[model samples]
Target: MEVDLGEPQMLAIGQLADRTGLSVSAIRFYEARGLVTALRNRGGQRRFLRSEIRRLSFILIAQQLGFTLGQIREQLAALPQGRAPTQQDWARISRSFRNSLDERIDGLVRLRDRLDGCIGCGCLSLRKCALYNPDDRLGRLGPGPRLLLGDAPSEPAISPAAAIGSS
Candidate 1:
């Protein structure tokens, strides 16, 4: 985002790929998706603004953080194309991700914490796990890994000794 008018104002597609470490096809894909734009020179060759490097960098980070391309495109559209984004602009854009980021983190945490517990599906074949679920009780919540779907276990798993005399 540093404005160095000293460098060329526009760069060729190959130069953009080199500077951004993206393949030519990837850069072209981004353009097709409207995440970046290219202009045609007199020879009909594609040229891109130097600022597109920063834009591509943002796209890379957003994808790494599990954002869908559509979501990244929406966020990038908020940035003004006439100039480089100021720090304040970035802050505002970051704020927009806060709720979504928190939700994503929460889901990951839930999966991490609950994945070991029996989901009442008996998939693990652990007959006496403390979190053992019986009779597909977790299925009452719905299909598709109900425990992972946020359904709580019906009870703490019964101890094996306690289960032995009960039939």
Candidate 2:
């Protein structure tokens, strides 16, 4: 139930939840995390500004895009506290976040292209591993899927048939 109380542009917590499609507890959690703020009514009930709808919506979208809560908080921090975020403020944050999203997309593309090849785990048990990794020399570079992580394979590439014949 929304408690209007004749307030101008202020929404009760439940009203905010309905508008943002978030549970009241979830809104409270965001508040505690400093992502949102609430004003107390005369009955000491939580009231959020109407502008919070957009803010919470942004939070939802950013979280779905793989942003951490801390990163969302930092982005929200760049906006003015007492007013609704302007288009310019959101654009500035988007410019900063775009670089990070681009890098992640590039990494996913790399992983997809190299997934069929040896990951440079240094085991050298697989036929492809013998050709790409060659006695686990990549282990000296570092651990954990070196080739997938953008590390070049130490040995020259060979056809799968040649590798299988050697095995």
Candidate 3:
């Protein structure tokens, strides 16, 4: 059903949950996390604008895209609060994710390209498998999956074995 914002449709909490396919508790959690908000009726029941369906949908889709709740909340928080977000507002907010999404896609592509080789070569035994890790080294590159992240090894991995033989 189309929400007529001009008509100012208000949905009860349960109705919002039913429409969004989220449990009532999950909706409350989102509210607590500052991802969405709800008002209280005269009887103290939770009430949500019908437009909240779209807001909750964005949260679900952003999570599916691998964004954490913090990230999603931050993006959504950029919009005007206490009101339904306009399409332009949503478009601008979603655009912020584009760069990170591209990076994720690139990482996935690299992983897919190397997966067969990593599995088939059986290089883990060598401990020096080119596909596994040519050098167990720590580079100037900060923390994280270094090789998988496409960083060249800046320095050889320092190990007690290397130190014992060197001395």
Candidate 4:
């Protein structure tokens, strides 16, 4: 249950699972997915380096943020081999994920702004609203309230205020 951060220490699978809060099978799954690696003892039981705790923590956090195993693998591949990651390594990985995070944030902000604009309008027509017809470059795309703001015409010069407020 104890991790010696200063030295390269081996942790039994159970210890690793307890520390990481992942089931043994889930830890094995991560290994199979190449998110973690462990050495086998002479008896063929898996033994993990203490560093793996941090790695598994990162994997779990990334998965919570909607990253696929492949994306997590790609990010982990950037770390220096045979050593714990330096702050610079972490910064580099953060930069890699920053763009996607920013895009998601920006999309949410746009949706929030749109929702604020729609509160009084009450258009509720998908065909007319840009929120629903995002593909037309007139509305926003994706599933959700944005797509159901109002049924606007396929090709009309209707202002957003008019579209949502119209009866």
lDDT of each: 0.78, 0.84, 0.73, 0.73
C-alpha TM-scores of all predictions = 0.71, 0.77, 0.72, 0.67
Which ten-residue region of model 3 has the weakest summed lDDT? 118-127
Candidate 2 total steric clashes: 0
Instruction: For model 1, name the residue pairs that clash.
Output: none
Clashing pairs in 2: none
| Model 3 lDDT tens row, 1-167 | 98664855889988999999999999999999887878888999888888789989989987987889988888888887777778899888868878888899888887787554432222344434442344333233555555567765454444656545543
| TM-score ranking, best first | 2, 3, 1, 4
Q: Cα lDDT of model 2 overall?
A: 0.84
Which 10 consecutive positions of candidate 4 have the poorest summed lDDT?
139-148
For every model shown, the clashing-pair count is 0, 0, 1, 14
Q: Find the number of clashing residue pairs for candidate 1.
A: 0
Candidate with the greatest TM-score versus the true structure: 2
lDDT of 1 by residue, 72-138 (tens): 9988888877466778887888899789888888778878886665544546455433345566666
In the range 71-159, model 4's lDDT, one tens digit per residue, is 89998999876677778998999999899888777766666766644321334444433443433443343333432343333554556
Every candidate's CA RMSD: 4.4, 5.6, 7.9, 6.6
> Candidate 3 regions off by >4 Å?
1-5, 119-128, 131-145, 152-167
Q: Once superposed on the true structure, which residue ranges of model 2 sit more than 4 Å away at CA?
A: 1-8, 154-167
lDDT of 3 at 102: 89
Which candidate would rank higher by lDDT, 1 or 2?
Answer: 2
